[model samples]
Target: MVSTIDSPEYTEDTFISRLLTKVPTPAGEGFAPGDDAAIIELEGVRFLGCADGLIEGVHFDLGTCSPADAGWKSLAVNLSDIAAMGGTPTSALVVLEARLGEADGESAAQAAYEGLGECARSFGVVISGGDVVSADRLALSVTVLGELPAVGEALLRSGARPGDLVCVTGRLGEAAMALATAIPSGTDHPWAERLHRPVPRLEEGRAIAAAGGSAAIDISDGLLLDLSRLCCASGVGARLDTAAVPRPAAAEWQGSGAQRVAPEQLEKAALGGGDDYELCFTIREPLLTRLDELWPEYGADYCVIGEIFEGSGIEGPDGRLDPAGWDHVASGRRSLE
Candidate 1:
């Protein structure tokens, strides 16, 4: 079943319904926050479009990051959205909002934009022009445009079925651990790089799409939260084994005895961590063996964590799994530390 949230000022359904009714998708699907990106078909060409933002206090702190890190992250998140849609990113429009008169200065702002441009070029994308706004705080908005060059159709959240196997690419919790460990272990730590510089799983996403994945979503929030969103979109349920989630080893992250984080904490971070930027997708039962045999070229490593079911909600080791982590509008965040 699709989930709904109601509040005094706004409701998710009312706003989404109004948008869908008033603004038709034409030949493509309409907007949904967690759908990753939208496909727009115009003049027989299908393009993927998505926008993501990062604010100074909410997403990052300037004290803990350089202007370059902020810029890289802004564009990186948007690119992850494109990857989730199973498309190849071609170009991007970047919006920068900054407090110009602040101590950071014009040089700092220029550095940030340069960082974004470098990231775009590295990922084989062109950085088109966008507006710059003067504000009290720093904010970056990135809109990426991509195309389905090889894929027959864009992978969507609503495409999941009851019998599909739920899979995730690469390891989880490293990003959350990066965040949790940085303060005590120092910013110079290797894990900190995972938190700051995230690689979008574009190749893996394209591979999944080409392999006929039933549904796909990037794990920008948490594995459990994003998985729940996918289940809700597909009107199905999932039974996940927390033990199956891939977590970073204690020795790998624990640089010293004093910096050691608990094993359960690491597992928690893997299951319900944010900003991993990995892809969580579902595949048909028949395709798993084939994918496993020819796995080298599909890009990053992946693992099967669960399966889609016929009902609503997600089941975890303890029972009902709460899809709570990295809420953008909500001030409180799930803390692994």
Candidate 2:
């Protein structure tokens, strides 16, 4: 007999909560499932581990994105998780599922590995062991491992407090625009690289942690939804200055190179678009001066967009901003954008 809890109507969040209840964390583990990565300690050293997967139809269109782009993104997304914890990525294991018999399958698989190798070299990460299997469509899963020297050094979503200033690194909305325009793989479109080959903000994450950031999360999902998760983790609320959000410049999306996006569309994209692997973090007011002094050394673009407060949810100038972002189950059922 099917229980009420097993109904198909459960949202992704509800399913995860129910699943966790059935499989509680081990007795002595250092961390649980809700955060960006799992933290574990061994011989006085703390480590972070996380996994992310990319599917051909859902994450990329094979006709639009090259195999190399897919490979780079598969690892980069996981690296963003490590970055969220303010840890340096040390190694990774990749699981590749290839359509071996297809005409371009072998070549695509080779190019994908080349891209993965290139990304690993750039980040100084070791390509650890993994498995490969034949499948109907391409899929890749990556597991990244990282380390922190001390127990309290790794940043956590639960660390944010009221009066903390919320900040983000780099400009947002380019990836969303790129997707909307359906720019080809090799095009010179300004937003194309952002969607195809995103740079994980590893150095910037470390800088934020070193400068005493209270909490941090990578913006793999939309800014508003991810910020809501951070606030919920910390048991606080947030107020955002919509004008302060750093959106992509109009010139970047305008002109003959790519489809011109109006200012209002850009604003919506920045607010709700996902796949921009930038870091969103919170710092106490007292440490703002220190962050200002240290941020430049890392060559990161950042801005203060909001602040934490004592409450239950996120609010913008017009009042509570809807918690809308890329939800796997919900998006599969309908369009979010």
Q: Point to the candidate with the largest TM-score.
A: 2
Colliding residue pairs in candidate 1: none
What are the per-residue Cα lDDT tens digits for candidate 2 across 40-98? Answer: 76687668899999988889878999999899999999888888888889999999989
Runs off by more than 4 Å, candidate 2: 1-10, 28-30, 149-152, 296-298, 333-337
Q: Which residue segments of model 1 deviate by more than 4 Å?
A: 1-34, 101-103, 183-188, 256-258, 292-299
Q: In order, what lDDT does every prediction score?
A: 0.79, 0.82
State the RMSD for candidate 1: 3.3
Candidate 1 accuracy as lDDT: 0.79
TM-score of each model, in listed order: 0.88, 0.92
Worst 10 residues of 2 by lDDT: 328-337
